[model samples]
Target: MKTAEGLKDIIKPENLVYRKSSLITDKPFSYCPGCGHGTTHRIIAEVIEEENLAENTIGVCPVGCSVLMYDFLDLDIQQAAHGRAPAVATAIKRLMPEKFVFTYQGDGDLAAIGTSETIHACNRGENILIVFINNGIYGMTGGQMAPTTLEGMKSSTSPYGRDVKMMGNPLKMTELVAMLPGTCYVTRQSVHTPAAVRKAKKAIKKAVGYQKKGMGTCFIEIVSNCPSGWKMTPVESNKWMEENMFAYYKPGDLKVPAESDADAENKNEQ
Candidate 1:
């Protein structure tokens, strides 16, 4: 009789000769089955391989569900204190201007505790990329209410449903970040479907490209699903994100800075 691993290999062809996955271990991930983190990990790995940036890129990981991302992403990684990834990335990018730097942060870490750090990073126009995952609830902490928790959503901390009067409205970080002068590009995308995933990959690649060109602060916000925290199956969570979450946080490019006024004037004179 064949082993389960053998059966899996037989069922799925491994003919595609892409770069080997950067994940180092065979241990199963600790994430709940079907969690969006796995998908995000694959996308990031593919992007790193396709862009040939594994050697020069560094990632600052936040203290949320993705805290253990260093174990998976083979590139150089630094773990940051809760909500401090942006600040850490800023320092690294400034010190090593030639290296590509990015921070992977969840909504709870970025929109809640790290709001000031994230905002200031964008305002300062740091030449770095930020991948923000907004899954609505605080997935790492037993489904607590987060700053991005939608109205009428029920979580362990908000069992009675989010009360706008008491809890305040959902914080739209992407929209807010777009308003800052330092931001060169900002877009909100989702990863719940094949087409959406492709679009998200494009957005991420664009953000990385902007940083490589010395453009300040490229941000991509991805609307993901937390199946375990949402008390639903993975399919159900995807449905919820599409039906409810998208209505509130419609995905699109929120900002793109034009050429510097000085550069444009110089070109015109020549």
Candidate 2:
């Protein structure tokens, strides 16, 4: 009886503004400290939960940090070979068209090795969501340079900074895929700040909604920061990303159904 009336204002509604999504498991994330993969995982899980897709949502993960999504989200997920997530996702979605299928891939897995699978999926208009995390460097494999690595950027493989003359230019894979007619929506976002996180969540939810309507491939690129790989603090990595990555990638919708692209952009503003 001592605790019956002891918590009058201790647990008010105001004190519980934000709580963890139910879709996330109790298992701790394995990403490095300050890794964007954790935030991205939370956002995707939140969207799937909010959309009531928790049961039918299936994730096709690749051979990178992105594969950890299975441990975080409480959904049916399958792993794919290096750069073959799209192909796997295609099969999953085709076999169960009623289910929402998505592919979680990193820059190295999607842009470099799985480039063909990703392109063909977009070109063929696979009705699936593609969450592409671009941290520039390959975080899982000892911080090597990735296809989306910035020009003149340094990595374990590029000790003296990326030499564009020798290595060509950093690939703008998002824009390249957006150019395909099969793609329905393509947006680049980040999760560094609260506002950016909100935008990314909206982008994810929209992609899920579109897929439910049997829409074409929806690609959402998250331009993220890699503190460990970039050799900077989390805050510094975010600052550097805004200064360098955003300048080249430019966060926004790269493509949409021409008739509805303008409308979609306007809604995002509202």
Candidate 3:
């Protein structure tokens, strides 16, 4: 409870240990108090700096919660139409192959309207990183059931919970995208806990590194918590996600390098 001048001595330059990412500007985040967007943003920024890709990195975002993500990142961000980010990213990456291109999209944006775009781009082997945040509902556009909405999960539109027989099954886009021959690496991660945060960051770093190496497309799905949309407190949302979301989505590597690379590494070790 001290003024700026009063705390100077106690908070000396050496006393400062950790700081926010420089890529994060003074612009305040518009995400809800406990939304995962901020944490995901910070993780991406740190990896961009750690991998020395901040300057050359280009980000594409489309309609939905991810549309505003550009406000938090300091890199060059392109705004695409609803479900059109993959097309924009494909163009950007193809024209300037040297630049590190990535897209930040939500389940509503990627799995719902942009499913075709996402599939075609990945199938073409576009060397870009796709950061997909699946909270299972449309957070920005009311709490409607999204493509990833779990079975029996209630939403504004699905007031009685999603019924498999009536609404069809929740789309597992990550697993579907993983089977594409163009995809080089695929992982499902979460940022709800400290340990999970570390793993998400590592996954991001690897995805970016893979792009730099011209490895095919990389898709990272973050099964995040949406407290407001889920009608739960931030803490409750985290717990709910762990219990329900993780059970269905299940965080882990969905796909990785082929056996050829493993054999080559084994020979090198020998």
TM-score of each candidate structure, all chains considered together? 0.88, 0.93, 0.92
| lDDT tens digits, residue span 171-261, model 1 | 9999999999999999998888889887888777777677878979999999999998899999999998999999999999888657573
lDDT of 1 at 261: 39
Candidate 2, run of 10 with poorest lDDT: 257-266
- In TM-score terms, which candidate is top? 2
| Tens digits of per-residue lDDT for model 2, 81-107 | 999999999999999999999999999
Give candidate 3's error at residue 155 in angstroms: 0.2
Q: Answer with 1 or 2, whichever has the higher lDDT.
A: 2
Q: Give the true-structure RMSD of model 3.
A: 3.5
Give the alpha carbon lDDT tens digit for every residue of 165-256 in model 3: 99999999999999999999899999999999999998887787678779899999999989889999999999999999999999999987
Enumerate residue pairs that collide in model 2. none
Pairs of colliding residues, candidate 3: none
Give the C-alpha lDDT of model 1: 0.87
